[model samples]
Target: MHALSELRQARRFVIKVGSALLVQQGKPRVEWLASLAAEIADLRKASEVIVVSSGAIALGAAKLGLAKGGRGSLADAQAAASVGQVELARLWSDALGHHGITAAQMLVTIGDLEERRRYLNASATLARLLEAGAVPVVNENDSVATEEIRFGDNDRLAARVAQAAGAEAVLLLSDVDGLYDRDPREAGATLIERVEGVTPEVMAMASGASASGLGSGGMLAKLQAARIAERAGIALAIVNGTYVSPIARALDGPVGTLFVPQGDASARKAWLGGRLAPAGVLTVDAGCAVALEKGASLLAAGITEIEGDFARGDLVAIHGPKGERLGQGLVEYTAAECRSIRGLKQDRQADRLGYAPRAAVVHRDHMVRT
Candidate 1:
């Protein structure tokens, strides 16, 4: 099969366009946006597609005529984002309209994706857009987002979108072509083609931000995005956005850095790991902890203590004896019930709680082993 076919066969995908790709000469690149819309139009015929876009701040800055080399404070940045987001959506709508595709703009904050209910709601909205044959163009809600809670970069936002949308792959398009052994401009630096896994050595090769005065994210951010995709069992590709058909070319495997998925974790597990909020903690013994790490379920006997009050089905963090977080899982019983049955066997749960819900406090299927 053709390399591009791999991506073509994907049921869903999230494509991220960097600030550099969206802006040129301190303004939105109309032609680039049109080209990307055209590409998405083609891909939509074969698969569902969602776009995680950047450049709101850059566009806003240009529109507001912010002085160059001025003090770039958070207030300035936020002001710019407010101005630019309108233009960003307007450009997207006009560009995609050329191909008879409607574009729907969706602005999100980190809090939305980190919370389970909000995450599910966001996912549902995007899925509905896909079902309606419309492209959902997502961006960070920069106008009100504080630095502490900001996604920091669209690369990470794209990964979260991929996870939330149950996408099979995430394509991160940026100024650079792909990862290299070192800075490509430096003497003897070579491009690293395919990475089966992201090792410390590979991460060490990453450099800081680019010389181009476009965006904050660099090679390291893309690497971090890959790690997020990896944990979600979603493939990731980093390619140059300068090319006219960059997305098409990367899907065809012309040349790019591909980050392989770690394992086949279900969408629920991915959601649990990538999107859920932990309401409490479950401390376990060493043997039980190892079992949980090895992908085993959490039983009543293994649970030493229930640290917080939470309802049944609420997300909880599983901790080891030393208080290290082993992983997060949906608890089978209420915190009160769990506490009452601590150190009891599976059969004893019924007697303690008046009735047993399941054989384990957290079934393996409901748990995401870290």
Candidate 2:
């Protein structure tokens, strides 16, 4: 099992800030937010950081004088989220601005991450923001996301974002120091330093609700998030965020429970190969088949046929002329666009399409050989 020190070696990270740590009695914790911003500023000197924040509903509920923690009707919760999103974004912008850091807000729903095209778009957007030296503040679209189709807690949402961003690790800073063998409120409960995997026994240790009653996630939700990280070969840790500079403190010592990564496949490959329902199929000629064998990208000149109505970034099965399945990959062009440039060389593709298409219909980096 790895220790908290592993965080020091990671180049990119996704940090989840729960409602309990950011909101108190229905108001934002300005001082704590400032402390967190300072730590993030320091961390950004050597690494890229992404924050998954959850406090809009809590903050909004307080302002609207509705049931706290979104315990009331779904409509009420949505209304509170509408009011809180503005405040949440402003708070993060103000806090990060103090340290000369630009804060970018990204709101998404579960469908955004689950759908291939939207997933790629979201990932690319985040990459662009990070490349420009800005920290992305991601949150679930609670205001419009229905309760039946929403991620009620931010923990699982953070894990999905980590996967999308190809982050090295995830840090879930919450109210508790770490996972305990039992409810920490119990006298005999003890903290577990390292978790090799999220086993049934380990999962049993989690509780349902947070102590602060301001957030929907608890130890159980965190464990679920850890499972996602473990499958994606990303390290994850749970630590207390109540203290000053908690992220810095955790990285300097063994202050949290580290969940070791167990995935044997690359995160991208795992995601690409795991799609059970491919959106379309592309049948390439023998020339393309030969090039693919040499690990070359799938060029437009090699494509013989395109089937199914699919958009760019959608998963498409690649087939050789002999009707044998070559593999599956994300396409770079829509079906209509592919038809306009199929079997055309580089210059011909540009002439026919009236624009230069990407170098490859399916880039080698986005392909998974079966």
Candidate 3:
């Protein structure tokens, strides 16, 4: 009955459960998980739900007999994940089966979400599962992820998955209830009921982990997740796991920290923001360069040279004469077309390439300043 009515209207949502929620008193709480699964099943009646869960490493650590403060190193954590992932999925499957729902396990690494093709493929797979009436359970492929790009926290990973899947909202369930004006543990801290924007003041209230728990993320990580969701034009909410129907309640406007999207961005923009790397570089003439710098569309006549082999629609770096990267954008033509039209006059581009998609090599709307 919590007032998150807006959230309930969303047809698709991503729910992230932190490790601390899964492990209580240093042990896996199967009962709590069963309750969570039941709530998810209830939600599934009205919407497609994708669960992004963390706890494989924590469960693995317990199984491997690693005592508190005994997790050796990154290698040890990876090893634990390998051992616990199977068990984690099995437990979820068993719990979900009680509700007559099947859960599909999807383990992915940073590379999978960062690359455009892989990102689309991953999104397609999740969509297929939802269409087939199966819940897609996602987790980072901790066994192979390095520290640099590893979504050390599933909160951010869940946001990324939600964005990729075109989900309308993301629900992050953790130990804490929601964001606060200051540390809740402090004497006078107060809960922040709604967050319209992730401002500097809000960021200043973020704090690191306090409890000796299995989770890697804290409030700061949750805020970062909200930022990602906002940028992708998805609503976000942070709630306490103790609420058995937190997901449903959040959608109903219950007491939680809600983050409304700033505005809706095009799918292409989302893809660009999610791009891992640019395939090549496009250098334009001074006039074209100036136009681009001033937020003008990239014209075919502005091309002086194209570096690297890239196809149409591939993300490329736009550079000026002095090798300064003006921005990154989706290329309109293939490397061959670029070469054919290199140094051609604006009116002569069509004659050189036989046709033109647009006057510019990269459109301003398709570009993002680096």
Query: Tens-digit lDDT track for model 3 on 73-115?
Result: 8887888888879888998899899999999999998777877
How would the candidate models be sorted by TM-score, starting from the highest?
1, 3, 2
TM-scores for all predictions: 0.77, 0.73, 0.76
Question: Where does model 1 exceed 4 Å of error?
Answer: 1-5, 67-71, 208-211, 275-370
Q: lDDT per residue, candidate 1, 205-265, as tens digits?
A: 8986764666767888788788778888888888888788778777665677878788767
lDDT of 1: 0.82
Whole-model lDDT values for every prediction: 0.82, 0.87, 0.80
Q: lDDT score, residue 141, model 2?
A: 90
Question: Of the candidates shown, which would achieve the greatest TM-score relative to the real structure?
Answer: 1
TM-score of 2: 0.73
Off by over 4 Å in 2: 268-370
Q: List the residue pairs that clash in candidate 1.
A: none
Top-lDDT structure, candidate number? 2
